[model samples]
Target: MAQRGGPAPFPDNPFQDPAAVQPRPGPELDAYNPFESSAPPYQVPSAAPPPLPAAGMPPPQAAAQPPRKASPTEPRNYGSYGTQVPGREKAARPPQGGPRRRREPQGLAFPPQASAAAATAELLKRQEELNRKAEELDRRERELQNAALGGTATRLNNWPPLPSFCPVKPCFYQDIPVEIPADFQKTVSTMYYLWMASTIALFLNFLSSLAWFCVEPSSGSGFGLSILWALLYTPCSFVCWYRPMYKAFRSDSSFNFFVFFFVFFAQNVMYVLQAIGIPNWGFSGWILSLIALRKNTAVAVMMILVSLCFTAVAVLGIIMLKRIHSLYRRTGASFQKAQEEFAAGVFSNQAVRTAAANAAAGAATNAFRAP
Candidate 1:
């Protein structure tokens, strides 16, 4: 069997074993292997030594050190990397420094001269506006003055230096009459009546005194005393009745008329006191009559009687004045309506036109300079 198996099929190939198939052990496994070299551990080459100095000169000095490399974990910048081309690798440049240049503004440009011209135009426009205002004010003042002089009822004329008529219509009197309203006229009439009544009462009181003097001649009264009383009553009566009436007639101002009436009404009361022979009554009568009455009683009584009659006439006059005032009041209202109509007709349109013109001018000026 040995001889037959001896032809032992060719020795089993050791190469077919898994463990023997591995690389053979050699210097490759040694700690130091000069002959076995790998791709050279990826080492970065050291910088080439500086060029040797000329023949006998000292070695070249080193340049200042560049900044150290960043760690692998740090951000890597490819900004300096160049694209791969045939054979070129352009060196990267350091970032530039210093202040950035400013870009010039574009679009519509106004020269310095244009700006100055615009300013001058604005100043001129302002001056024109002020001048216009001044003229307007002056015109208004003139209008007011003319109105006052011609009376409030006067129509306003747009053209200057032309005479204007009162806008109020003519009343009972053909001449321009004070244009008081109906209500105001009634008030004036009432005031006049009151004042006249006071005067009449004073006059009647004087008549009573005269009758008394006639009955008793030895009553120690005199003409001088009566005359003195009459004088005092006359002026007070004027203040009480006439002055207020006159004021109403002249101005037709309700406020002024009322003021005069109240003041005079007070004075009338004082006259009544004096007429009744109250002691220390009037300044002139008491002082002057006291001295004169010492001689003649009859004459004094006569004078007193005449004053009484005068007072009665004043009463009648009050009634008459009231009637006349009532008539005037009705006429005054008509006048006022006419005056208002005339004013509207004359000035309203002119004022509107002036305002419109000014506004249009302003709008035109703004449009010319639209942004």
Candidate 2:
């Protein structure tokens, strides 16, 4: 009989019986288990043994090798690469894109924990050999300032390196051997001599430029500018970079160090530009000399000589710049200390205070007048 509206009409097999089919998997015959990774290696049965040793024919029996007993091994498993096995001691390897190791750090400043005793000690100990400065902090700066001025040391002006018969008096007293420390005297003296050479180079530049003017009337502008440059650069270079360097080394003044480094870098850059010799710039550079050589040989000779001097000056400037930078890194000069020194100096100066007062008052008055 067919049932309606229940599941659906089903055909039943006459030979099949639900009661006879046993579903239990006990210790008798095992079912196929795909997850049994611990299963032993599959072994194929041996072929029926070589027909009983071939009926005793003096056979190749002497060449037969003794069979080796195979070591028991669990079956190889798939889907387990880059993962920890049951007995592994090492961790899983990192991915191919992992961060590289043993990379060196560059220019990471690990500032000392004990750089300053107090905020006021910023300039003193933040520089070189700070461990010794723990004692005598108060009297040190006063003595330095006094020594800088002629209050403590009787430093007479002996600059210009001229004789008594000459009318032009010696300007500033510069005794590098006497004043500068033993460690730094050589460097400072070298710089002083370099400066003198630079002065000579500038003068030659002016003379060669004058000769250029005499040869070609069109170059009168360059000659005029050259004279101006010589006069301006000579004294200004001395005052700007050289004096600042002198003061920095003499008093261990960080502010002066900052000034020296800044001005001297620009000074070296100017040396390079002068050596390049752009037209109408009043320098005996390569371009100007080569151009003059085609017109007048005598004047070109002078210009070429001056250009060589400028080149030498530029090269020396680069060497000295590197040397100075190395000293700056190794000595008691830091940007933080320089800032502190500058702040301390500004606050102490009476003129700066007066200027500040005037500026503030003017600002206030202007603001009051604004609608």
Candidate 3:
């Protein structure tokens, strides 16, 4: 009776265990009666018999019955969406604080591949880039071939401008095109020409000083000093700053770069002083040139022209200094690297090692008396 009236029961199947099937909904749940006006709350009568009256003792008259309250007949809807059955409710939820279970996906899904045209387009684009790279490589290859066959390969160093008959052989081999990288070649050539210009300027200053002596015999001392300056600075200038700069750019040597910076800065300072033309100085500088203005127009003009040459060289020196410094910075050379190079070179020299050993031996002897 309790198992067959309300709704369909779950069936016996392999997907569910038959022994574990839940009890079916019963007839009592389907008997909810919310429409009757006078009906008392329906209560199932008990199976046990009612109490009997004792010997001539009648049961006390039942108390007057209370009126039955009527319930509303129309049902109101809650927000639940699924099939709702009476007299059944879920159990309370478990408490907090446990590892969450991993949810497995209900189904496997594979996204579709891209179109064939898209893949072909990507492949073509990559092929084009490869072709472009090949073209660039071929161009560079031709440049290398030409350079090997006809360019710097055939050139030789003819610096010092010395003749074959001279007893002193050429001291240095300098071919800028061959030794220097292409990026620095133009700058190196400019510096080389500037050196020649400076040489010519110094010689002109001597000739101007000689002209001064001819105009004023008492000023012969400057002329003599001018000759000395010409002969001394001509070769010294070549050896000092210029050669260091050449070597610096040639090998990208930090030590040589530092050497060039130190010496060339001093050389620029000398150029400035020479341009000023202090009295009794070998240079026909601004002072001597201006002084000649009162004596002879021709001498003053020649001296001023020489001073201008010196000034030009000074200006060019400053510009080249900045240029070389920029190049040096780009080469990633630092003073610490220069110091390391210097220390290595010093220790590697056989003469320096010999001298150091001898000095150490003498020091140790003096420290510990003769043994």
What are the models' TM-scores? 0.26, 0.55, 0.56
Write one digit per residue (lDDT tens) for candidate 3, span 115-146: 66778889999999999999977755665575
Summarize candidate 2's per-residue lDDT along 290-360 as a digit string, tens digits: 99889999988998888888888889888987897788788867889999999999989999999999999
Winning candidate number (TM-score): 3
Q: Residue 368 lDDT in model 2?
A: 100
Model 2 CA lDDT for position 362: 100
Sequence-dependent TM-score of model 3: 0.56
* Candidate 1 residue-wise lDDT, 1-371, digit = tens: 34764566344786786675786677757677555444333458589966667998877767796555555445766644443564576765556885566776887678999999999999999999999999977765665576568754554323123334745432222111123344556555555555555455445445544544454455335423554556676566555445545555555534334444465545545544443454233222333234335645654544455445444544544455456446446545344554665566455798877987899999999999998
User: Where does candidate 1 stray beyond 4 Å?
Assistant: 1-179, 218-224, 239-241, 245-262, 271-371
Q: Model 2, poorest ten-residue lDDT window?
A: 68-77
Candidate 3 residues lying further than 4 Å off, grouped into runs, are: 1-158, 361-371
Residue 3, candidate 3: alpha-carbon lDDT: 70
Candidate 2, residue 42: the lDDT equals 52
lDDT of each: 0.53, 0.80, 0.83
